[model samples]
Target: MDNTKIAVIGAGKIGGAIAIALKNNNLKVKATCRTEKRLKELKSLGLD
Candidate 1:
């Protein structure tokens, strides 16, 4: 596999869910949210 990294901008409900789905499938994901709290949540979701 190429293992290309994914960048999911705007980590809202849909975006976050997509990021999570990618992560669940063992893909590398990077998501950006509007707030620090949301960003932290994404980190907790296993994102960097």
Candidate 2:
């Protein structure tokens, strides 16, 4: 089966947690944040 690709616009705690959980379920995650700091933190959490 083809996996789903998701784009999360916010990298806040809730959003990040959702993205991570989706990824763990085999979905591809693309997280977008308002600031470089948040983006870096998301990246560190393994979101692309």
Candidate 3:
């Protein structure tokens, strides 16, 4: 991952997709969502 840090604020549909894309590229990803449910969903997708 080259020690790179990426953060996605308000990770909804589009933002979540972007996060996933970056993660699939093996980049460091940090995503934030408004609700716990959404956060759990993102976590389930393997996003941090």
C-alpha lDDT values of all predictions: 0.90, 0.86, 0.95
Alpha-carbon deviation at 3 in model 1, angstroms = 1.9
* Per-residue C-alpha lDDT of model 1 across residues 1-48, encoded as one tens digit per residue: 458689999989999999999988888999999999999999987997
Model 3, residue 11: C-alpha shift (Å): 0.4
Question: Which runs in model 2 stand beyond 4 Å of their true positions?
Answer: none
Q: lDDT value for candidate 3? A: 0.95
Q: Write the per-residue lDDT of candidate 3 for residues 1-48, one digit (tens) a residue.
A: 588889999899999999999999989999999999999999999999
Q: Which 10 successive residues of model 1 have the least lDDT summed? A: 1-10
Ranking by lDDT: 3, 1, 2
Q: Positional deviation of 12 in candidate 1, in angstroms?
A: 0.7
Query: Candidate 3: which stretches are off by over 4 Å?
Result: none
Tens digit per residue, CA lDDT, model 2, 1-48? 366799988868898889989888888899987888988988887889
Clash counts per candidate, in order, are 0, 0, 0
As for TM-score, the candidate ahead, 1 or 2, is 1
